[model samples]
Target: MAVLAQDGGLAFYGEPDEAREWFRADRIEDIYLRLAEAEEHEWAGRFGAAPAPAPGPAIGAFRQWVLLTRRSLDLLTRNRLTLAVLLGSPLMVLAMFAVLFRPGAFSPESPSPAATVMILFWIAFGGFFFGLTYGLLQICNELPVLRRERLTGLRITPYVLAKATVLLPLLAVVDALMLGVLRALDRLPAMGWGTYGELFVTLLLCSLAALALGLLVSAAVTDPAQATMALPMLCFPQVLFVGAILPVPVMAAPGRWLSCAMSNRWAFEGLGHSLGVERLWATGRSPLGPPLLDSYGDTFSRAPVVDWAMLGGFTALFLVGACLVLTRRT
Candidate 1:
């Protein structure tokens, strides 16, 4: 009997038991290099002549997640440039903020209202940038490998989740450091740990949402260059519509509604509310403070949870969107 594999591998067996033993051996020595192509169907025969032993039970999603997370961490840590950017970018931005925004802006006596808002807006934007940059290349660069693994019963859920699991903690740390460093430098106001905690949560969520957005784009694109090309497009709307440059209420009707959709908008407002920016602008000695707050009416009016919920919803939506994109890509 002759067995021909998909890759044109040919094997001759004298009897049924001998053919079964060859299939069980799981070894197909291709007389030629092409013959070495080991496919189960060739050994099984086109009409299912011989059946190969089944693989062990499939791996669980949790196990896959763990393994994937380990591999991802290994890759991230080994890439010194990536590790430096992840940890160093925030500090670099913080220094620029410290130099760019004058001290005592958050001070009660003659505070700089514009400076205050800039500090908050830039801080929020920084977190988003970190998350987005970290995630943008993650999937696209490894897509070939991912596509190959999908045939091995890899679940999209675990794959997407492993990306998140590996990166979110780093984001959390970077965000916390942003707050702590700004406070230490007096770029941000001295506040209770609780207030700092609220700010931290807001920034972390902001990063999470951006990370999800990055992952979605990464999965949709074909290569690293394409992913890089998307950075400006993704970031432009985030900065423009975040309500920092133009307070949402003061924006035109179309701009007003669109601002509601920006994850950075929620994050900025959340940080504002947590820091009591409304009250600061209301009573600060800066002559411009009240006018600015009036123009931003009701933006920081809602509770922080409302903003939190919005950010959380965006993260969930983007992550699920990434999973869907991956499935389609395959």
Candidate 2:
């Protein structure tokens, strides 16, 4: 069988000359020379170069990566509690509050139900605090395991892609639930399909930004205890600086600069603006103020600035930084 293995599909098994059909001619010659030299180093019973392994389907590089990604996602799903908490807690809390508070408190007119739902769900639930909790948790939990898997030849990019893919659906469900509750309570405006698309994009981007930062920290940190200790420091400052509760322009100069560095600031600003909260702020009517861009007082005002742009930029920075750290040789 071993002999037959070397004859057909395994024609290149031990002979460099056989490699010509599979590899470039020059490459075959170079491999042949190396094989010949390696033969000299063979022990009493061993061949210098072991027979080449059998090839399978001509899967492309991306297809191989997808397979790897699917494997990682399968592993993640098996850890149901972790996945559930990571994706479910925020939505659960939001629903609880909507149940507890009078629907009128969140209206776009006063505290606008639409405004409160958008802010708490997207900005507070998914943005700053989620980044702190989920980001740190994902890293502290996954980094070491991933590092071991990577050392065994698994690709980091595929793993990241898989994890991100698994996360998106959960985020979508959360966004939908919150959006549904607000709408059912008559808190949201008569949104067209476009509004749903915009909200999904904004929330997903926010989740990615948080997830990336968490992975970056996980890859960079040496200890899990230290990561746990650091999460609140990362989260609390972000909440204070993101203008969820305060106007960025009104902050002390140092605080303003701090807000510039906080992903939460951009997220809340973008989400707030996208939901028409900034319009109130702009027209000097909102409890919060000095929104990042143009604001109007119309009931269904367009954002003075694009929220997606800020979210895209922040998410890109975090993902790139995380990839760099994850792919670095350890």
Which numbered prediction scores highest in TM-score against the true structure?
1
Instruction: Score residue 196 of candidate 1 by CA lDDT.
Output: 88
In TM-score terms, candidate 2 sits at 0.66
| Deviation in Å, model 1, residue 17 alpha carbon | 21
lDDT of candidate 1 at residue 326, scale 0 to 100: 99
lDDT of 2 by residue, 77-147 (tens): 89898777866787676676566555554344555433453444343444445554665655545666777
All candidates: CA RMSD (Å): 4.7, 9.9
What TM-score fits each model?
0.88, 0.66
How does model 2 fare in lDDT? 0.58
Off by over 4 Å in 1: 1-50
Q: What lDDT score belongs to each candidate, Candidate 1 first?
A: 0.86, 0.58
TM for candidate 1 is 0.88
